[model samples]
Target: MTNHWLFWGFWVMANALASFMWGSIVLSATPAAFAGMLLGIVVFILVYGTLDAYLIKQNLSRWHDALRRSVYIKAGLQLMNVFLAFGWPASPELWAGIISVGITQDRLGIAQNHYPFGFALLNTLLTGAILSLMVAALTAIIFFIRKKHESR
Candidate 1:
């Protein structure tokens, strides 16, 4: 439980930073706003999802030598999912689909458009940040529980 909390905290902070960065880019564009937003999402997927996947796999492999095979397989599947979702075009429908899937997995809520320029930007940032935090929290809880059971 302690470990889960720690992991969740870290994830929330990371996601907050990521959201702010992406939201700023998305909201600052004059024309081609959608395109810019897409670009930002792509960058985020590449940097956060892919790179984090690698790091996660490495850590898991090191932590549980006997469970490496299964852990690696699961991580691979997650990476694939992230890649697929990231490659898809960014639209309200697409986001809705992603949010639905995430909700089914107990991840995060849907992203909605906000009012006013500043408010919209803040909301966008919060949406991403909160979702990322949820993912991290869930992942940490699962891993911690598994580790506890294994140890017992």
Candidate 2:
């Protein structure tokens, strides 16, 4: 349950960040903007989902090393899901659906959107940091909780 929450939270944060990044880079509608947004979404899913899954798997393995091998395989499956589905950009709805699948497969929700961009490059940098931090915090919290529960 906790894992689910963490995963969704991370996905939501990543989604929002990707949108913000693309929005800042290409404000007006152009082929470049469309392509950039697609690329951004792909990168975001790969990086954030892979890292979070790895961390969770590591924590889970600590409880039962014998289960580690299977856990690793499951991680690969999850990674594939994110890469194949969540990475695609057919439409905003499709993207959102894929991201939701990634989150729910593990059990999780979208984090609060914090668009910190105000003006210039600073806006982009700040917004990116805020989004990254939001996802990181959720990931860390889930790992911590899992560790605590396992330790018991």
- Cα TM-score per model: 0.36, 0.37
89-131, model 1: which lDDT tens digit per residue?
4333234334433452344332223223333333444355445
Off by over 4 Å in 1: 1-31, 62-126
What lDDT does model 1 reach? 0.42
The 10-residue segment of model 1 with minimum total lDDT is 66-75
- For candidate 2, give the lDDT of residue 49: 50
lDDT against the true structure, per candidate, is 0.42, 0.42
List candidate 2 stretches off by more than 4 Å. 1-14, 17-26, 56-129, 145-152
lDDT of 2 by residue, 40-65 (tens): 44454555556546656777544333
Candidate no. 1 TM-score: 0.36
- TM-score between model 2 and native: 0.37
